[model samples]
Target chain A: MSIPNDRKYLSTHEWHKAEGNVVTIGITQFAADELTDVTYVQLPRVGATLQAGGSFGEIESVKTASDLNCGVSGTVVAVNEALTNDPGLVNRDPFGQGWMIKVQVSDLNELNALLAPADYLKNAGH
Target chain B: MLKHTPFYDFHVSADARMVDYSGWEMPLMYRSVVDEHQQTRNSGSIFDVSHMGRLHFSGSDTRRFLNLVLTRPVDDMVVGQSRYALVCNESGGVLDDIIVSRDNKHYLMVCNAGNREKLIQYFTAFRREHDLDFDLADQTESTGMVALQGPKVIERLASVLPVDVKSIKRYHFETAKIMLIKLSVFRSGYTGEDGIEIILPAMMAGMAMKMLAGKMDKENATLKPAGLAARDTLRLEAGMPLYGHELDENIDPISAGLKWAVNLDSNFVGVQKLREIAAQGPKRVLVGLELEDRRIARQGTTLATSDGAPVGQVTSGTFSPTLQKSIAMAFVDADHSAIGTQLSADLKGSPSQARIVKLPFYKRSNP
Candidate 1:
């Protein structure tokens, strides 16, 4: 339920932090808690272009799976390889060690479309 | 609204993730599925399985009636003995897998909750048509079932139970009293672990669980509260067949790798068809599948040849918390169900390589 004040969240449960034109992407703690015991993470390949609100990959728990969506239009620059072997990191540290991908922003205008931390917390019923 | 068990409030207070299961509001997990699963495998854990149906059969002709309906021969079963068997339809298709326990004066049958109504209807119809002189009573609503499982489970149970838990042999039950409430404690469980399932009055369920849980907390013991999610994973690791997942009305026990439960010489509802299937062999058979990768192949996933030709479908699959690998049970073509046959599973449209292996992905060290 603790959403980092500096991050922006999507209604689909993903969060992003824009540092200049580069953004770090990860699912919020709310999402992590909802999808308990993540076993596998299908991440988007590096250098793949993704549109805002589009699904880039999927995350699987023991009993269910959910698609991971992009909060803003960007090009995937780097994916967290640590998650490939230890998907439970998402459950342990959804904000810190569990970042899924880093992207180079393709449209800064889309950033304004995301919800703030407070708004996201309210929207997620946290 | 779904039906709730006696321990529903206990589960909610423990922060269980509730899910709808066969019209029952059941806890999927208390902490996490993987954690609970590991805890159960390494230490001790308890599960609330009261949603399953419990039936009592009594009358002068109880033995004859059950012997004719159940696949296993229960005629010679002594008191306190339990046998795993399947209730088959007239065409050899399975109605439900059940455990029949013989008490001193009557018989008790435990079956899947989803198949309770069907089973009761079948029993009623059979009795009416055949003029069987036995009384069938549905004991599920008033009974509460809890299973304490794992290697160290006996220690935790012995702490609270008055009886010497070790005296009851496997697949046997003994009548005892917990807090003055009569209980039928069975030395059996689904996880293939050494444990006991206590069946008691529904109103006493909360107190009984609190006693067990309190004992664990007081002694700093290894006993933890697990849920259906962990139960599913544990049973999958143990290679046990679930009712809706592995066995269904269209699937016969012979094809589901449950031939041991079926007695060819015994006269049951589907004995003749079962005999024919046994002689000719089933066209498809259930086999254990070991995925080469960590990708979990879930139920309904299409299994096929390595070259992409479809062969069968996965019935039950999960990531085994013990093995740290994904495993599945699939009903593949009988000829292709060999121990070393290579196959592929269409996991979300991508084919994952897998191989058929001998059942039971994990076995207890002492077992």
Candidate 2:
């Protein structure tokens, strides 16, 4: 799978896409593939505050569980509720319908610290 | 360096995700764990279990030696019978759980891969101390083992195997020849399903795999290649214990709920301690737990009462693909081990409601 050029990635494998004042956060395809079958996802509730480089929730696969991290500080405006019933969506389409949370970006400068698509692809050993 | 099984090339070519297990490079899963698990329950699946230890015991005093070491009585075991037994330390702590099979000329024992060297040393020391006469040979690397497990396994095997596999009763085995290679087929498995585990020479494993694969339809495989991940889940759903998780040198068969495999009347190494434990009752007992939600309560999770009193800790847990629920096995205080007892599992910081249930959460109706 190709890394979407429109987003910036964290070294921990979380992708952040900034659109106007909101940034949508999700795990990269490489991370999902490594987790095998995604059985459950726990996302931060709407209106919850999140800080950059802080854990926002959790993601669980059949074999293990991992923390879901955030790259941009903001208030969570929306969450992917569909994941509650269909966690496999993350395995099938990790970039689109698998987006975990949408945050009202508190600062645009935080995005500069994340890695570019090419850099992420290189660091991820693609 | 990790050891490679004879089926290593096949697993790689099949795109299996290989991992290091008990110092062996084995496949964790080929496609997905849940998919392989469902394939086993619905139809059939083949597993490469060559990493487990296979030991051959022979000599004039083999029977007497086994009777003194094994928790189960070996005198009554007729030829071609297999029994689940445990080797225990002097304090009654489980050293390892093994399957002892009575063959025509000798006895075969299969044990966990991680404990293979430890068990061999233990047995060797015992033989030296007691001046027992027997020959023990490590055949794990010289032989290969595979399990064909599922509801459809017997019918599929009956057509290809030279013998009547269906007629072989549970816990019994037969020796047969396939492609001029001698093979031992046992009507037994770790999964809670009807299946057979076969042992053959290492050099013939590839030919046997190809021959078995020819029987299945490629488009919709009847016997798909499963991995260690599915095998663990399948055994967990069946309420079977895994070494290092449920059984250890610090844990005993009495507390692990394996009393049936222990014959106290026999003068085994741990018979005296086990008898005392049986008379006084085990302080902690293994029990099954069903969580209220899908979040897995993994190993080492703390178990507590509704009032926040710590009761026990989880030994193994997974989101069951068959029952579609989160199930776990834990060793709680004997007073809290009864079915229907409500306990809470501390998942990280939050607590999840859990209820004690029967040991086996899933049972095949036809069997």
The best candidate by lDDT is 2
lDDT of 2 by residue, B1-367 (tens): 9999988888988889999999999999988898899999999999999999999999988999999889997999899999999999899999999999999888999999999999999889888998988999999999999999999999988888898999999999999998688989999999899999999999998888887656443747779899999999999999999998999998999999999999888999988999999999999999999999889999899999999999999999998998888899999999888899999999998999999999898899878
Please tell me how candidate 1 rates in CAPRI terms: medium
What TM-score applies to chain A of candidate 2? 0.97
Looking at model 2, give its docking quality level.
Answer: high
- Lowest summed lDDT across 10 adjacent residues in model 2 chain B is found at B211-220
Q: What are the per-model DockQ values?
A: 0.78, 0.84
The collision pairs in model 2 are: none
Those runs of model 1 whose alpha carbons end farther than 4 Å from true positions after fitting are B215-220
> What stretches of model 2 exceed 4 Å from their correct place?
B215-219
TM-score of each: 0.97, 0.97
In model 1, what is the error at residue A9, expressed in angstroms? 0.7
| Model 1 Cα RMSD, 1 decimal | 1.5
What does the lDDT read for residue B149 in candidate 1?
94
